[model samples]
Target: MRTIDRRPLALAGCLFLAALCLAPQTAHAHLVQTGFGTFYDGVAHLFITPPDLLVAIGLGLLAGLCGAAASRSVVFALPAAWLAGEMAGAFFPSSLALPWLTTVSFGAVGVLVALNANLPRALLVALACGAGLLHGFVNGSTMVAAGTDRLGMIGASVSVFLVITLASGLVVSLRAHWAQVAVRVAGSWIAAIGLLMLGWLVRGQG
Candidate 1:
Protein backbone atom coordinates (compact mmCIF):
# COMPACT_ATOMS: atom_id res chain seq x y z
CA MET A 1 0.00 0.00 0.00
CA ARG A 2 1.19 3.50 -0.82
CA THR A 3 0.84 6.43 1.57
CA ILE A 4 -1.01 9.51 0.37
CA ASP A 5 0.18 13.06 0.95
CA ARG A 6 -2.36 15.41 2.48
CA ARG A 7 0.10 18.14 3.30
CA PRO A 8 -0.43 19.89 -0.02
CA LEU A 9 -4.14 20.18 0.60
CA ALA A 10 -3.53 21.48 4.06
CA LEU A 11 -1.00 23.97 2.74
CA ALA A 12 -3.51 25.31 0.22
CA GLY A 13 -6.00 25.91 2.97
CA CYS A 14 -3.36 27.63 5.05
CA LEU A 15 -2.45 29.96 2.20
CA PHE A 16 -6.07 30.93 1.62
CA LEU A 17 -6.57 31.64 5.30
CA ALA A 18 -3.54 33.86 5.45
CA ALA A 19 -4.62 35.78 2.38
CA LEU A 20 -8.16 36.34 3.58
CA CYS A 21 -7.28 37.13 7.17
CA LEU A 22 -4.47 39.58 6.50
CA ALA A 23 -5.61 41.22 3.28
CA PRO A 24 -8.02 44.08 2.53
CA GLN A 25 -8.30 47.12 0.29
CA THR A 26 -6.53 50.40 0.99
CA ALA A 27 -6.01 53.63 -0.95
CA HIS A 28 -2.49 53.05 -2.15
CA ALA A 29 -2.44 56.14 -4.32
CA HIS A 30 -2.65 58.57 -1.41
CA LEU A 31 -1.35 58.80 2.14
CA VAL A 32 -3.83 58.44 4.98
CA GLN A 33 -3.72 61.70 6.89
CA THR A 34 -5.56 60.62 10.01
CA GLY A 35 -4.44 58.08 12.62
CA PHE A 36 -0.75 57.56 13.50
CA GLY A 37 0.60 59.06 10.26
CA THR A 38 3.94 58.57 8.46
CA PHE A 39 5.75 55.46 9.67
CA TYR A 40 2.67 53.76 11.02
CA ASP A 41 0.83 54.71 7.87
CA GLY A 42 3.26 52.67 5.80
CA VAL A 43 2.72 49.63 7.99
CA ALA A 44 -1.03 50.08 7.86
CA HIS A 45 -0.95 50.47 4.11
CA LEU A 46 0.52 47.00 3.57
CA PHE A 47 -1.89 45.26 5.94
CA ILE A 48 -4.91 46.88 4.34
CA THR A 49 -4.01 46.24 0.70
CA PRO A 50 -5.01 42.89 -0.72
CA PRO A 51 -2.96 42.94 -3.90
CA ASP A 52 0.27 43.91 -2.23
CA LEU A 53 -0.27 41.53 0.64
CA LEU A 54 -1.21 38.68 -1.69
CA VAL A 55 1.93 38.94 -3.79
CA ALA A 56 4.19 39.23 -0.77
CA ILE A 57 2.58 36.16 0.78
CA GLY A 58 2.93 34.31 -2.52
CA LEU A 59 6.62 35.08 -2.65
CA GLY A 60 7.03 33.74 0.88
CA LEU A 61 5.17 30.55 0.04
CA LEU A 62 7.29 29.98 -3.04
CA ALA A 63 10.45 30.45 -1.02
CA GLY A 64 9.25 28.00 1.60
CA LEU A 65 8.61 25.40 -1.08
CA CYS A 66 12.25 25.68 -2.07
CA GLY A 67 13.47 24.92 1.48
CA ALA A 68 15.44 26.79 4.17
CA ALA A 69 18.19 28.14 1.98
CA ALA A 70 15.61 29.69 -0.35
CA SER A 71 13.58 31.04 2.53
CA ARG A 72 16.65 32.65 4.00
CA SER A 73 17.47 34.18 0.66
CA VAL A 74 14.05 35.79 0.45
CA VAL A 75 14.33 37.16 3.97
CA PHE A 76 17.65 38.76 3.14
CA ALA A 77 16.86 39.92 -0.37
CA LEU A 78 13.27 41.10 -0.24
CA PRO A 79 13.46 43.82 2.44
CA ALA A 80 16.83 45.15 1.35
CA ALA A 81 15.78 45.30 -2.30
CA TRP A 82 12.48 46.93 -1.38
CA LEU A 83 14.21 49.60 0.71
CA ALA A 84 16.55 50.32 -2.15
CA GLY A 85 13.66 50.73 -4.57
CA GLU A 86 11.89 53.04 -2.15
CA MET A 87 14.95 55.22 -1.94
CA ALA A 88 15.18 55.42 -5.71
CA GLY A 89 11.52 56.29 -6.01
CA ALA A 90 11.87 59.05 -3.45
CA PHE A 91 14.97 60.62 -4.95
CA PHE A 92 14.13 60.10 -8.59
CA PRO A 93 11.12 60.76 -10.76
CA SER A 94 8.39 58.15 -10.90
CA SER A 95 7.65 56.01 -13.94
CA LEU A 96 4.20 55.22 -15.28
CA ALA A 97 5.35 51.73 -16.12
CA LEU A 98 6.40 50.89 -12.56
CA PRO A 99 3.05 49.71 -11.15
CA TRP A 100 2.67 47.02 -13.80
CA LEU A 101 6.02 45.58 -12.78
CA THR A 102 4.46 44.23 -9.58
CA THR A 103 1.82 42.40 -11.57
CA VAL A 104 4.62 40.73 -13.48
CA SER A 105 6.22 39.74 -10.19
CA PHE A 106 2.98 38.33 -8.87
CA GLY A 107 2.29 36.38 -12.03
CA ALA A 108 5.80 34.99 -12.26
CA VAL A 109 5.95 33.91 -8.62
CA GLY A 110 2.50 32.41 -8.78
CA VAL A 111 3.42 30.27 -11.75
CA LEU A 112 6.54 29.00 -9.99
CA VAL A 113 4.56 28.08 -6.90
CA ALA A 114 1.80 26.36 -8.84
CA LEU A 115 4.37 24.28 -10.66
CA ASN A 116 6.22 23.50 -7.41
CA ALA A 117 9.42 24.26 -9.21
CA ASN A 118 12.91 23.70 -7.86
CA LEU A 119 14.77 26.66 -9.28
CA PRO A 120 18.40 27.46 -8.61
CA ARG A 121 19.16 29.50 -5.50
CA ALA A 122 20.69 32.33 -7.43
CA LEU A 123 17.60 32.74 -9.64
CA LEU A 124 15.24 32.66 -6.68
CA VAL A 125 17.25 35.36 -4.96
CA ALA A 126 17.17 37.52 -8.05
CA LEU A 127 13.42 37.11 -8.45
CA ALA A 128 12.85 37.97 -4.81
CA CYS A 129 14.91 41.08 -5.19
CA GLY A 130 13.00 42.15 -8.29
CA ALA A 131 9.61 41.71 -6.65
CA GLY A 132 10.77 43.62 -3.63
CA LEU A 133 11.95 46.47 -5.79
CA LEU A 134 8.64 46.78 -7.63
CA HIS A 135 6.66 46.71 -4.40
CA GLY A 136 8.91 49.25 -2.72
CA PHE A 137 8.95 51.57 -5.69
CA VAL A 138 5.17 51.81 -5.63
CA ASN A 139 5.17 52.41 -1.89
CA GLY A 140 7.72 55.18 -2.13
CA SER A 141 6.06 56.91 -5.06
CA THR A 142 2.76 57.03 -3.22
CA MET A 143 4.21 58.71 -0.12
CA VAL A 144 6.77 60.81 -1.93
CA ALA A 145 4.35 63.67 -2.56
CA ALA A 146 3.49 63.91 1.14
CA GLY A 147 7.01 64.41 2.48
CA THR A 148 6.85 61.31 4.73
CA ASP A 149 9.15 59.31 2.48
CA ARG A 150 11.63 58.30 5.17
CA LEU A 151 9.22 57.16 7.84
CA GLY A 152 6.86 55.55 5.38
CA MET A 153 9.64 53.60 3.69
CA ILE A 154 10.90 52.33 7.02
CA GLY A 155 7.43 51.30 8.15
CA ALA A 156 6.52 49.59 4.90
CA SER A 157 9.80 47.69 4.64
CA VAL A 158 9.52 46.45 8.22
CA SER A 159 5.90 45.39 7.85
CA VAL A 160 6.56 43.56 4.59
CA PHE A 161 9.60 41.79 6.01
CA LEU A 162 7.63 40.51 8.97
CA VAL A 163 4.72 39.39 6.82
CA ILE A 164 6.90 37.45 4.38
CA THR A 165 8.84 35.87 7.22
CA LEU A 166 5.72 34.69 9.01
CA ALA A 167 4.10 33.30 5.89
CA SER A 168 7.20 31.48 4.68
CA GLY A 169 7.89 30.12 8.16
CA LEU A 170 4.40 28.71 8.39
CA VAL A 171 4.62 27.10 4.96
CA VAL A 172 8.12 25.72 5.49
CA SER A 173 7.11 24.15 8.82
CA LEU A 174 4.70 21.83 7.03
CA ARG A 175 6.22 18.59 5.72
CA ALA A 176 3.15 16.78 4.49
CA HIS A 177 2.35 16.11 0.84
CA TRP A 178 -1.21 17.43 1.03
CA ALA A 179 0.03 20.72 2.38
CA GLN A 180 2.22 21.03 -0.69
CA VAL A 181 -0.75 20.49 -2.99
CA ALA A 182 -2.70 23.16 -1.20
CA VAL A 183 0.13 25.59 -1.72
CA ARG A 184 0.08 24.87 -5.43
CA VAL A 185 -3.63 25.49 -5.60
CA ALA A 186 -3.17 28.74 -3.76
CA GLY A 187 -0.50 29.63 -6.25
CA SER A 188 -2.93 29.02 -9.09
CA TRP A 189 -5.36 31.45 -7.55
CA ILE A 190 -2.66 34.09 -7.29
CA ALA A 191 -1.70 33.53 -10.89
CA ALA A 192 -5.30 33.87 -12.00
CA ILE A 193 -5.62 37.18 -10.23
CA GLY A 194 -2.42 38.39 -11.81
CA LEU A 195 -3.64 37.41 -15.22
CA LEU A 196 -6.83 39.37 -14.72
CA MET A 197 -4.85 42.38 -13.60
CA LEU A 198 -2.64 42.07 -16.62
CA GLY A 199 -5.65 42.01 -18.89
CA TRP A 200 -6.98 45.14 -17.26
CA LEU A 201 -3.68 46.87 -17.81
CA VAL A 202 -3.70 45.95 -21.48
CA ARG A 203 -7.26 47.16 -21.92
CA GLY A 204 -6.43 50.49 -20.31
CA GLN A 205 -3.43 50.87 -22.54
CA GLY A 206 -5.42 50.11 -25.66
Candidate 2:
Protein backbone atom coordinates (compact mmCIF):
# COMPACT_ATOMS: atom_id res chain seq x y z
CA MET A 1 0.00 0.00 0.00
CA ARG A 2 1.27 3.44 -0.85
CA THR A 3 1.56 5.45 2.35
CA ILE A 4 1.02 9.17 2.62
CA ASP A 5 4.46 10.65 2.61
CA ARG A 6 4.60 13.40 5.17
CA ARG A 7 7.98 14.73 4.12
CA PRO A 8 8.43 18.05 2.43
CA LEU A 9 12.01 16.97 1.96
CA ALA A 10 11.07 15.84 -1.47
CA LEU A 11 10.69 19.49 -2.13
CA ALA A 12 13.49 20.57 0.17
CA GLY A 13 15.45 21.94 -2.73
CA CYS A 14 12.48 23.89 -4.01
CA LEU A 15 11.60 25.18 -0.56
CA PHE A 16 15.18 26.11 0.05
CA LEU A 17 15.29 27.93 -3.21
CA ALA A 18 12.07 29.68 -2.41
CA ALA A 19 13.46 30.52 1.00
CA LEU A 20 16.52 31.95 -0.66
CA CYS A 21 14.40 34.18 -2.80
CA LEU A 22 13.18 35.79 0.39
CA ALA A 23 16.49 35.57 2.16
CA PRO A 24 17.72 38.88 0.87
CA GLN A 25 14.88 40.48 2.75
CA THR A 26 15.53 38.51 5.91
CA ALA A 27 19.19 39.35 5.63
CA HIS A 28 18.17 42.93 5.92
CA ALA A 29 16.93 42.01 9.37
CA HIS A 30 19.29 39.76 11.33
CA LEU A 31 19.79 38.46 14.86
CA VAL A 32 23.37 39.60 15.24
CA GLN A 33 23.69 43.19 16.37
CA THR A 34 26.11 45.23 14.36
CA GLY A 35 28.46 48.16 15.12
CA PHE A 36 27.04 50.42 17.79
CA GLY A 37 23.52 49.19 17.08
CA THR A 38 23.54 50.57 13.57
CA PHE A 39 24.71 48.16 10.85
CA TYR A 40 23.69 45.14 8.78
CA ASP A 41 26.85 43.11 9.47
CA GLY A 42 26.30 41.14 6.30
CA VAL A 43 28.06 38.12 4.76
CA ALA A 44 27.60 36.02 1.65
CA HIS A 45 26.55 32.98 3.66
CA LEU A 46 26.07 34.12 7.25
CA PHE A 47 24.48 37.09 9.04
CA ILE A 48 24.82 38.59 12.53
CA THR A 49 24.40 41.82 14.44
CA PRO A 50 22.64 43.23 17.46
CA PRO A 51 18.99 42.53 16.95
CA ASP A 52 15.87 44.43 17.81
CA LEU A 53 13.34 42.80 20.18
CA LEU A 54 11.29 41.64 17.22
CA VAL A 55 14.19 39.44 16.22
CA ALA A 56 14.47 37.82 19.65
CA ILE A 57 10.83 36.85 19.79
CA GLY A 58 11.14 35.47 16.29
CA LEU A 59 13.97 33.30 17.50
CA GLY A 60 11.90 31.93 20.31
CA LEU A 61 9.33 30.94 17.72
CA LEU A 62 12.10 29.37 15.71
CA ALA A 63 12.91 27.22 18.71
CA GLY A 64 9.34 26.06 18.62
CA LEU A 65 9.78 25.14 15.02
CA CYS A 66 12.80 23.06 15.89
CA GLY A 67 11.03 21.35 18.74
CA ALA A 68 8.11 20.61 16.51
CA ALA A 69 10.41 19.18 13.92
CA ALA A 70 12.42 17.21 16.46
CA SER A 71 9.50 15.90 18.47
CA ARG A 72 6.34 17.34 16.95
CA SER A 73 6.04 19.40 20.11
CA VAL A 74 6.17 23.10 19.29
CA VAL A 75 4.99 23.94 22.78
CA PHE A 76 8.23 22.95 24.43
CA ALA A 77 10.62 24.73 22.08
CA LEU A 78 9.35 28.32 22.58
CA PRO A 79 9.82 28.30 26.31
CA ALA A 80 13.10 26.52 25.93
CA ALA A 81 14.43 29.32 23.77
CA TRP A 82 13.12 32.00 26.15
CA LEU A 83 14.66 30.39 29.19
CA ALA A 84 17.94 29.83 27.44
CA GLY A 85 18.11 33.41 26.12
CA GLU A 86 17.29 34.94 29.48
CA MET A 87 19.68 32.62 31.24
CA ALA A 88 22.46 33.47 28.83
CA GLY A 89 21.78 37.18 29.31
CA ALA A 90 22.29 36.84 33.04
CA PHE A 91 25.82 35.65 32.17
CA PHE A 92 26.90 38.93 30.64
CA PRO A 93 30.37 40.29 31.57
CA SER A 94 31.43 36.96 33.06
CA SER A 95 32.01 33.27 32.48
CA LEU A 96 29.35 32.44 34.98
CA ALA A 97 25.80 33.30 34.06
CA LEU A 98 23.40 34.72 36.63
CA PRO A 99 23.08 31.76 38.98
CA TRP A 100 19.30 31.57 39.07
CA LEU A 101 18.47 32.27 35.42
CA THR A 102 21.34 30.14 34.27
CA THR A 103 20.30 27.20 36.35
CA VAL A 104 16.68 27.60 35.40
CA SER A 105 17.35 27.99 31.67
CA PHE A 106 19.63 24.98 31.53
CA GLY A 107 17.26 23.10 33.79
CA ALA A 108 14.25 23.86 31.63
CA VAL A 109 16.02 22.71 28.51
CA GLY A 110 17.16 19.57 30.29
CA VAL A 111 13.76 18.80 31.71
CA LEU A 112 12.05 19.27 28.37
CA VAL A 113 14.77 17.32 26.64
CA ALA A 114 14.22 14.49 29.08
CA LEU A 115 10.47 14.56 29.34
CA ASN A 116 9.06 16.24 26.22
CA ALA A 117 11.43 14.51 23.88
CA ASN A 118 10.55 11.28 22.17
CA LEU A 119 12.12 9.61 19.17
CA PRO A 120 12.05 12.65 16.93
CA ARG A 121 11.42 15.15 19.70
CA ALA A 122 14.66 14.33 21.48
CA LEU A 123 16.85 15.15 18.53
CA LEU A 124 14.79 18.15 17.47
CA VAL A 125 14.78 19.91 20.84
CA ALA A 126 18.42 19.11 21.38
CA LEU A 127 19.39 20.71 18.12
CA ALA A 128 17.01 23.65 18.50
CA CYS A 129 17.95 24.46 22.07
CA GLY A 130 21.64 24.29 21.33
CA ALA A 131 21.49 26.65 18.38
CA GLY A 132 18.94 28.87 20.07
CA LEU A 133 21.15 29.30 23.11
CA LEU A 134 24.13 30.35 21.07
CA HIS A 135 22.18 32.95 19.13
CA GLY A 136 20.32 34.22 22.17
CA PHE A 137 23.40 34.46 24.38
CA VAL A 138 25.46 36.25 21.81
CA ASN A 139 22.67 38.70 21.21
CA GLY A 140 22.39 39.19 24.94
CA SER A 141 26.10 39.73 25.28
CA THR A 142 26.01 42.25 22.47
CA MET A 143 23.33 44.32 24.15
CA VAL A 144 25.15 44.23 27.45
CA ALA A 145 28.28 45.46 25.76
CA ALA A 146 26.90 47.90 23.20
CA GLY A 147 24.31 50.05 24.91
CA THR A 148 25.56 53.16 26.69
CA ASP A 149 23.03 53.11 29.49
CA ARG A 150 21.70 50.39 31.79
CA LEU A 151 18.15 50.92 30.54
CA GLY A 152 19.31 50.75 26.94
CA MET A 153 21.11 47.48 27.59
CA ILE A 154 18.08 45.98 29.27
CA GLY A 155 15.96 47.14 26.38
CA ALA A 156 18.25 45.46 23.90
CA SER A 157 18.14 42.16 25.73
CA VAL A 158 14.39 42.21 25.84
CA SER A 159 14.31 43.02 22.15
CA VAL A 160 16.47 39.99 21.41
CA PHE A 161 14.26 37.41 23.13
CA LEU A 162 10.97 39.11 22.45
CA VAL A 163 11.48 39.30 18.70
CA ILE A 164 12.80 35.76 18.34
CA THR A 165 9.83 34.27 20.10
CA LEU A 166 7.37 36.41 18.24
CA ALA A 167 8.73 35.74 14.78
CA SER A 168 9.39 32.02 15.22
CA GLY A 169 6.07 31.45 16.90
CA LEU A 170 4.17 33.36 14.25
CA VAL A 171 5.77 31.33 11.50
CA VAL A 172 5.22 27.96 13.18
CA SER A 173 1.71 28.69 14.31
CA LEU A 174 0.53 29.14 10.74
CA ARG A 175 1.48 25.60 9.83
CA ALA A 176 -1.15 24.06 12.07
CA HIS A 177 -1.89 20.49 10.92
CA TRP A 178 1.43 19.29 12.39
CA ALA A 179 2.55 17.64 9.22
CA GLN A 180 5.78 15.84 9.95
CA VAL A 181 7.21 16.83 6.62
CA ALA A 182 6.47 20.49 7.16
CA VAL A 183 7.86 20.51 10.66
CA ARG A 184 10.99 18.68 9.61
CA VAL A 185 11.45 21.04 6.72
CA ALA A 186 11.10 24.02 9.07
CA GLY A 187 13.66 22.50 11.42
CA SER A 188 16.10 21.99 8.62
CA TRP A 189 15.55 25.48 7.26
CA ILE A 190 15.95 27.15 10.65
CA ALA A 191 19.06 25.11 11.36
CA ALA A 192 20.52 26.22 8.07
CA ILE A 193 19.66 29.77 9.00
CA GLY A 194 21.53 29.33 12.27
CA LEU A 195 24.60 28.12 10.44
CA LEU A 196 24.36 31.11 8.17
CA MET A 197 24.12 33.44 11.15
CA LEU A 198 27.10 31.78 12.80
CA GLY A 199 29.06 32.26 9.63
CA TRP A 200 28.13 35.91 9.68
CA LEU A 201 29.28 36.24 13.26
CA VAL A 202 32.66 34.72 12.40
CA ARG A 203 33.05 36.92 9.38
CA GLY A 204 32.23 40.02 11.41
CA GLN A 205 34.93 39.11 13.91
CA GLY A 206 37.39 38.46 11.10
Best by TM-score: 1
Locate the minimum summed-lDDT window of 10 residues in model 2: 38-47
Model 1 spans with C-alpha error above 4 angstroms:
1-28, 95-97
- Per-residue CA lDDT of candidate 1, range 151-187, in tens? 8888888888998899789889988999989999999
**Which digits, one per residue and each the tens of the lDDT, describe model 2 over residues 131-203?**
4565445444544454333333344434443444454455556556555345445444444444454455335
Report the lDDT of model 2 for residue 138: 43
> How does each model score on lDDT?
0.78, 0.41
Shift of residue 132 alpha carbon in model 2, Å: 7.3
Q: What is the lDDT of residue 66 in candidate 2?
A: 51
Best by lDDT: 1
Give per-residue lDDT, candidate 2, residue 12. 92
Range of the 10 consecutive residues with the lowest summed lDDT in candidate 1: 19-28
Residue 20 of candidate 2: its Cα lDDT?
42
Error of 2 at 46 (Å): 15
